[model samples]
Every structure is written in C-alpha cells, then in structure tokens.
Target: MGVIKGIEHVGITVPSIEAAERFFQQAFGAKTLYALIEKGGKSQEGDEMYDKNGLEPGTRIIAMRMMRIADGANVELFEVEGGHGATADAPSHMGIHHFALYVDDLEEAAARFRDAGGTMREGPIELGGKEKGPGNRCWFGVAPWGMQVEFIHLPSPIALDDQASSGPRWLPG
Candidate 1:
C-alpha cells in the first residue's frame, strides 16, 4: 500500500461562512484562499443523493470559504442553507471532536479568541513530564456557532516512545 501524506484540510460546517471567516481571521490570522457556492434542487435523483449524504432534500450550500491558518493546515468553512444535522455540544460525542491550532503565545492566542467573541470552554492547562514534557500547554474555546477550537503551545514536538499507542503522534498531548 502507498503511504499516506499529511492532512490537507479539515471541513467545518458553520452557520455563516462570513462569520466563520471573520472569526478565523481575527483569532488566528487566517487568510481566505477561495470561496464557492453550491446550488441544490428538489428533483427525485437529487433528493436521493442528498438523503444518502445525510442532507435535507433541496439543501443548498450557501457559501464555502477555504482559509489558511498561519503556517499550519487549511480549514474549509461551509455554510449550508438546509442540512439535517445538529452540532455536538461536547468533545465526548462520536465525531470530529475538535481541531487544534498551534501558537507561540498561548495567552495572546486565548485573548484573541476571546476578543473575537469565542468563549473559553476549558483549560489553560499544562502538560509536562510523561504527558508531553514541560513546554506544552493548551486551552479550548468555542466559537459563536458552537464549534470547538483548541489552542496549543509546544516549543518542541513530542517524541513517542516504543510503549506509545498507535494514533496521531501529533495529538493527545
């Protein structure tokens, strides 16, 4: 099998593309790369396709914006006019729990997030020693639309030991 490359982007469904774009830009200095709009119809075939994809029939993708966050990954923010899904309130729910961004200054990042109307959900906690060493810290914030965002500061990447579990090495630190 071919080896997989790194992640290119993460898609996030938001209530409003404009608001999400603004939040990302203000909080993380994310820049918009592109935008798109997808139209939906109520035809039988269209409805079937939408239903198969867990979307409401005739649901339209109102707007979508691809944003680049600092020097890390890209985030694709989508605004669907009609979708048959609900946002998960907590990280324990079975789905994409949250997305994290790395920052040099944890306090500054948290302040920017708060200034952008995001609520601090948890932590300005430390993770040292066996967890991820002395230089790592993190905090979680929720956007106005209830999307969870994590801000982390790690001056050095953690080196996994032989006893480490099989998962994303960059995560859970």
Candidate 2:
C-alpha cells in the first residue's frame, strides 16, 4: 500500500463562490488565495473529463476560490454551472458528514457564523465526560448551499495510547 502524507485541501461545491468567500472571511477569518473560472470543451463529454466525473457535457466551473483557513487547511469553493448531484441531507447522509473548524471560542464563532448567513443546525453543547476532553464544545451550522460545517473548541490535549506509533498533529498548539 502507498503511504499517505496528509490532506492538501478540501473541495466544497457552493452555489456562489463570492458568497462562500464572504462567509468564510466574516466567520472564520479565511483568506482567499485565488479565484478562477474553467470553461468546458469537447473533451468534457463522451468518456472525457466531465463525463467521467458525472458532470454535464458543457458544464462550466463558473467560479472557484481557494481560501486558507486559520489552521492552514485550504478550502476550494467551486461554483459549477452545470454540475450533477444534489446536496447531501447532512448528519444522516452516507458521504461526508461534516467538515469541522476548530476555534478558540465556540460560542463566539457560532454567533459570528450565524451573523455571516450560516444557519445553526445543532448545539453549542459540551461533550459529556472525557470522551472528547473537558469543556470541549461543538456546534453544527449549515452553509448557504446546504453544506454542514462544525465549529469545535477543544482546549485540552487529547490523550493517546502509549503504544500508538503516531498521533494527530493538526491541532493548534
């Protein structure tokens, strides 16, 4: 098996890249690195690029923006003009459940997210016991395009087994 390094970026389809960029900037202080638009060509259909990805023949990537989050994760916002597939129903969906954004203040972040046009879907509730760490709080919010985003505040370091070869190193120090 090939050894995997780490996540380079996460791609999310949005109705409008501008709106998504505004929300990310206002809510999470994300910075937009760049934006681009891709036009479909002959190779987009009939066993070509678009056909292989289930996109329509002349599907156009109307708007795309690459933004860097606080923790250095790059979020690629795509606005496809002729894409195929419906947004996941969330929480109950079989695919990606949600993408989490770790913050220092969960409550404040949730409030900002709401102010930035995000709808709160679940709690600012604390995790029970020590399964997640003391006082760790989490909240779920839905983006304008129906994507679920989670905000979490975990101040305590997670305990790892001594025999474990490697542990997660993505958390902010």
Candidate 3:
C-alpha cells in the first residue's frame, strides 16, 4: 500500500511573510495559524524526513508561517534569506515557480488578491485550449518570491459528478 495519506503542507518561499500572509488571506481566505523566525535551517532529522518528499539542507529559509485553508490543507509560507525565484525578465527560469489554488469564484479571488497588494499577471480566461473539457481558469498576483499563483475554478458539474465515463473509444488493433 502507498505510505501516504495526503499532503501535510507546501512551503512557499517569499520575501515578506506579512505581505504573503495578507495575500493568501485575501486570495484564498487563508488564516495564519503559526509563525516562526528560524535561524540557519531545520533539524537534520527533520530535513532527512522531508527530503524523502523533496526537501534539502543548506537552504536559507528564514521566516515561515503556516496558514489554514478551508480544505484542511496547510499552506506553509517560507521567506528565504537570499533572493530565490524566477525573475520577470526570465520567465522560463525553472524551479517551483508557481502553484494553483482552486477557488469557487474567479472574479472574487482576483479582486481580493489585488486588494491585498498582489498583482494579477494574466487572464481569468478558459484554459485547456481546443481540449475536451471547459477548463475555465485564472491567474493571479505574483508572490514575493517571484512565483505566479493561479486561482483555478474548474467546472463544477464534472468535479461533482459521481458517474464514471468510459475512457477512450477503442482504436484499430
């Protein structure tokens, strides 16, 4: 059996914890649950444990704040000491540059993000161009760490439908 239940949290490195906190609060209705200004880094054992999932040592994650979302998942905001993230000039500069947050309303989410001092980079348009389903999605304010946060409002009927449909029609064998 898989040894995983669900995601505990996702660390997001940012420049300012307060700013990021405010943005998340407005954008996704996230509330701050805890905060810490850690020096150096986390414990070696802790690092090792998390490393299995993709954490590493020597990273200068200065400040961290945990926020509680409506779905019970925790969003950990990490503010790194040095500048670490994609730059506006180089959009393709890889690494964890963005994360999508599923929201109920697109316009409301975008408005809240702007009100909370976050900048919207692109449209609340239909994604999955020329695809099967109507993937209505939207992009939002850049994070302090220079990552883009997208607010995705997927189709409700498909999301809630319980009936399973056939995968793909048979092909000539």
Candidate 4:
C-alpha cells in the first residue's frame, strides 16, 4: 500500500445537478467551480454514462455539476439518465456518510447552516478530558442532498485509538 493523502472531495448523487448546485449555493454558501455535460462517458455512481453497449442500444450520463465549499473540497453531483444504471440512495449504499469539516466558531457555523435551511442532528459536544482530550464536535442535520456533514473544533491534534474501547467513566466529580 502507498501513503494516502488527505481527502480530495466527495461525490453525491442527485436527480438534478442543477437543483443541487442551486441548493448548495443558497443553503451552505457553497460555490460552483465547474460543470459539464458529457454526452457519452463512463457511468459512475452519480454520473450517467451513455453508450451503445450490450445491455442497451445507447446508455450514458448526460450531465454533471461540481461545487465546492468555498476554498474547501468539492461535491460532485451527477445527473444520470435512465437505462444507464440504477441510482442508489443513502443508508444501504456504500458512499460518503458524512464529511467532517473543522471550523473556528461553532456557534456561527451552526447558525449559518441553520439559517440557510440546514437542520442540526447532533450537538456541541465538549470534547475534552484526560483520556478523551478537548474539542467540540457536532453533526449537521442534513445537506441539501440529505447527506450528513460534521463540524469539529479540535483543541489539539488527535487520532482515533482503536485499542481504547470504552471512555473514562465518571465517578461523581
């Protein structure tokens, strides 16, 4: 195996790429970086690739739209055409469950997300302890595409410890 770089971006499946583009702009202050409509391209989970193949006479992904969270990573949206492939939804499918983003101000981030029609699922978890360490973490209600996003404020650099089974138990401090 090779050393891995950080996450580049996440792709999301949408019925309408245009709708997703608009929603990201309005809801999360995301900006559109690039978009293209490939008449005949390789079909991906969110993309519709069209070609005259064995299964169908001609099947393909007609269009795709990609947006980014400001200067951050991007979210590629695909608008697949029928007969190309079946579109899968969240829960059962194997895709991105949530992308964790680090923010400076938790209050402001939450407010902005909510004001822009976002819903909050988890809370401002004060993450700090001798064992757990210090930080703030929470999960967004849902993205415009119904995907979950997490906002975390880490006090210090930390990594997940697989050996650490249970958290420190409180003894009525």
Top candidate on TM-score is 2
Tell me the TM-score of model 2.
Answer: 0.76
RMSD of 4: 8.1
Query: Residue 51 lDDT in model 1?
Result: 44
lDDT of 4 by residue, 59-164 (tens): 3345666678855677776665444233344211323667766677678877777776677776777665532455545546576557676776665544445426
Query: Any idea how many clashes model 1 has?
Result: 0
Q: Please say which candidate is ahead in lDDT: 2 or 4.
A: 2
Tens-place lDDT digits, model 1, residues 1-173? 24975678987877766788898899888999987553243322224544454444555555667899866678887676544255343111222558988787888888999999998966788877655767788889988888788888876566556534544355322
lDDT by residue for model 2 (32-106), tens = 988655434222231244434444444545556788987657887766555435434311112244798888888
> Cα lDDT of all candidates, in order?
0.69, 0.67, 0.60, 0.58
Once superposed on the true structure, which residue ranges of model 2 sit more than 4 Å away at CA?
A: 1-3, 38-47, 51-58, 86-96, 128-130, 159-163
Query: Each model's RMSD to truth, in Å?
Result: 5.2, 4.7, 8.1, 8.1
Candidate 3, residues 68-149, lDDT tens digits: the string is 8777468887665433433432111222557667777788888877776677876866666432256556666675456687
TM-score of 3: 0.64
Query: Each prediction's TM-score against the native?
Result: 0.74, 0.76, 0.64, 0.62
Model 1 whole-model lDDT (C-alpha atoms): 0.69
Model 1: runs farther than 4 Å from truth?
A: 38-58, 86-96, 128-130, 156-173
